[model samples]
Target: MKRLRISLTAQIFLGLILGAAFGCFFPDFGSQLKPLGDAFIRMIKMIVVPLIFSTLVIGIAGTGDFKKLGRLGGKAIIWFEVASALALIVGLVVVNVLQPGVGVSLPAIGAAAGANAAATAQSFSISMHLLNIIPANIVEACVKSDMLQIIFFTCFFGVALAHIGEKGKIVVECCRGIAEAMFKVTHIQMNICCAKLFENYK
Candidate 1:
């Protein structure tokens, strides 16, 4: 059993084959499996915010140097921007070369529909994108599950904790403990979930 569990690649291959077979024979029932996939994604997202916030708070408070943090953040931002630009350029080049849209005939849109699409695209500006990063309200941001806003708030709060000096140490330690506990809980849940998923498939 342990050896079989360790062979994850083979297990995955077997699962795909079995899943395909079931879907082929029972198309109607197979469609219901989509909820499982969606639920798993939601579970991951639910854990991510708290895990990120706690970890960031602990790290920033422990760093003891705001200057170093600023330098590191600058480097990270530069790297991220460069990577995003390169990805965008590559995608544009690929799309242009492939011209996948050339032969595809989309359904004829009415003038109003076409105008709406153009208006929607026009409304999406770089300045609005940047401004959205700053949360109007933290709770509202969390309720909306805006990842960038959550990250911004975490970093801002972490820096504030760092600036508190000695008083922040206790809070930092508490956050570190909470982070560790949450990670352990997540790990256990993941292991149980994976085991159950594999067992169900088998």
Candidate 2:
């Protein structure tokens, strides 16, 4: 007899169904579990910048040809834009259909925060958004989680890294290592989240 084991998908589906039942029966206890959900989300977000940078840099650097990299970048940008637009449209449709926050009341933000947001909106433009992808300070971009700027910088860095020949070999290898580590980290985080989700049942 094969060892009994549940597939990750089935485990997740089970967790969702049982979690809903648990929450319904224990509302106050469920409310205290918000931080687990938030921590899981935060863990996922933490992986994004490093994983993207490392994988993209390795991939672009591996191409070893500026002309080919440019074409690949063009296709990637097109795909990113189309996929993003479609995701936005689908998300809006789902939110409208579900009306998930329909009855929720949000606390008022401070006037200063509102004013800053308004000013930011007033100053924003398509051209500015495009230009902002070239970071004045690459370190700041990474620290702030400015993905576009980071990607823009990574493309250039990858091209330069490739052109450096022997010197770039170590950097490329390091990126490959980092990418693998991040993949493992992501898998571990998912398992941890799954265990946390199911732990209440026991």
Candidate 3:
């Protein structure tokens, strides 16, 4: 007998197909798996900040050019704005074209849910968001898992590390190690994630 191997991509694809079929055949059971889905998302989110911080710090430090970093940051902001605008336009066009919500009756959410939603809506402030990105304390930002703050702090730290020259190489190397470890962790998570998602649906 010959051994057969399945690549990760193929395994993930198989999982997706299986999950979809299982969900369609057993909608009630599939709906119960929402908690598991959320848990998996949380697992990935836990890895994201550290991975981003370590990798970006290493990248910015390696370049050792503030000008280059500034340019990169500018381009990133422009890309985000452009992509967001395009997404909004496309979404509006699609919704208008399809009129998917027409004649659709949605279940009314609970009073508590509406209250929470209103509270969330009230919390939006552009000035506050910009201030938050600067993060008064890096430790608090990490604890809160505030990505913008983490990125802001990491970029500043990287530039500072770069300015120190030889003294900072040691730190950069350490960050490189952290980045590699995070990558490995993410890989392991991905392997388990597909299996776990399938198991949940099953």
Candidate 4:
């Protein structure tokens, strides 16, 4: 008889099903497993900034042509905005159509917290958002995982390296190496997340 080997996707699917079942049948016990999920989320978040910075730096530096890089950046921004707008429209349409909260009755837990959040959101301005794109301190940006600031810094660094011509090849090579290392680390973190998910099932 041949033994069955479950693929990672299948394992993930199975884990989701089992998790749902557990949550439905043993709400208290399932809630206690929140820490496992939180840990996995934190680890995954830790991978994003460094991985994105390294890859973006390598991509821009390797392009070698300033005009081509500018065109690429323009296309990327346009695509991102268009895609985001479409996604938001779809979500709004579905939510309006389904009215998911229509039948739900929940208690308001924190009136003060809600008011503070509303005030903060209302005070948010485009100028503030633009200012945030420029990192005051890069180390602080990385620690906070401010993706836009990190991306801005990385793109500038990459452009500077590209402009330096052959003199910058050594730094470009270093960025490429860092990117490869980050990729491996991301893969390992993903595997660890899956392991933690499976452990929660037990």
Candidate 5:
């Protein structure tokens, strides 16, 4: 009973109820808590990009089987497409039903909009997007935290490491270690965030 009372899920449910009550009764106090939420979001963003990059590299290099990799990649692509489609459909249905932004108004596009469009026009091109997967400056990609470019570069890097056999084990092991470390960091941060949230609710 004590374990159940102290469990994370129980804490979360209690927090949710208390938070809702507080928000209902003290809107101003609730508004003042926004910084805590923002801090949590920042912590999450800090961990996620590195985690994604390291995990992708580890996954590709560790597998070491081209045929298996290809098969799995094909299945992943299909699942991604299906999941994306389903999300779009559900989002459309919910938006139609709720009409959350029905009364919102926006200014008409101006000359600044055209300039913005021109600057980003090439990014929308399929060929350009594909080309951009191969980063001209890997350091720049990592600094900018460009996830797609990082993933693309890592996949090729991992494949090359796999192809090199015993000699490449050192690099692969390093990446795997990094991935595991990042996962632990992320887990710890998430638990900290949850604890803070639970305290705030109290």
Candidate 6:
């Protein structure tokens, strides 16, 4: 019974069975539980910016060499671009070979105003995604929870800290301590969240 009580996998399995039973018997009731799922996701998202900022700052400050950081950054960017281009080329090749869209009866291009609106929204989303890399305001970037900007700022700040001589060592040590504490906290929270999620399912 103790083993049963503490086992997360068992709790999750039990929860899934119960939830499926509930949905099967009471669709409307199950639908109302959607908020629980959304709340869990939101909770996870709320942790992102701080976690990234702390870890990045610590990593950069601890490095002790600006040239090493620059080399790492350059290599990372090059690898990212190469991987992205490869993915794109592979997708295009596969799509051309499969031609899944060729014979499918698509909705008439001009028929649906709603479809056009959706397409426009998608385009806007893509454009915003690209533009968001440029920080409007540092505070806004942090508040909006932009991971990339937070990482960039933290890394740059860390490098500056490293260059500040004796004073920098104290700051770097503090940042490292903070990063470790935050990591531990994050880990504990994740375990708690997972336990709760499993319990809910059970």
For each candidate, the alpha-carbon lDDT, in order, equals 0.80, 0.87, 0.86, 0.84, 0.79, 0.74
TM-score-better candidate, 1 vs 5: 5
Any idea how many clashes model 3 has? 0
**Per-residue C-alpha lDDT of model 1 across residues 100-126, encoded as one tens digit per residue:** 778778889999999999999989999
Candidate 4 per-residue lDDT over residues 141-173, each given as its tens digit:
999988888999998998898889998889888
lDDT of 3 by residue, 96-202 (tens): 99988799899999999999999988997898778868988888988999888898898888989999999999999998999999889878877887763333221
Question: Per-residue lDDT for 69-176 in model 6, tens only?
Answer: 788779989999999999999999999998777877877666588788888887786668767676768789888787777776777777888788778878777777
Better of 3 and 5 by lDDT: 3
For each candidate, C-alpha RMSD in Å? 4.8, 4.3, 5.4, 4.6, 4.0, 6.8
Clashing pairs in 2: none
From the highest lDDT down, the ranking of the candidates is 2, 3, 4, 1, 5, 6
* Model 4 quality (TM-score): 0.78
Model 3 spans > 4 angstroms off? 1-3, 67-71, 74-78, 100-126, 196-202
Q: Candidate 2: global Cα-lDDT?
A: 0.87
Model 1 residue 149 distance off true place after TM-score fit, in angstroms: 1.7
| Highest lDDT against the true fold, candidate | 2
Worst 10 residues of 4 by lDDT: 193-202
Candidate 1 lDDT for residue 137: 96
User: What clash pairs does model 4 have?
Assistant: none
What TM-score fits each model? 0.69, 0.77, 0.75, 0.78, 0.81, 0.58
What's the lDDT for candidate 4?
0.84
Better of 3 and 6 by lDDT: 3
Ranking by TM-score: 5, 4, 2, 3, 1, 6
Error of 5 at 63 (Å): 1.0
Model 5 weakest lDDT span, ten residues long? 193-202
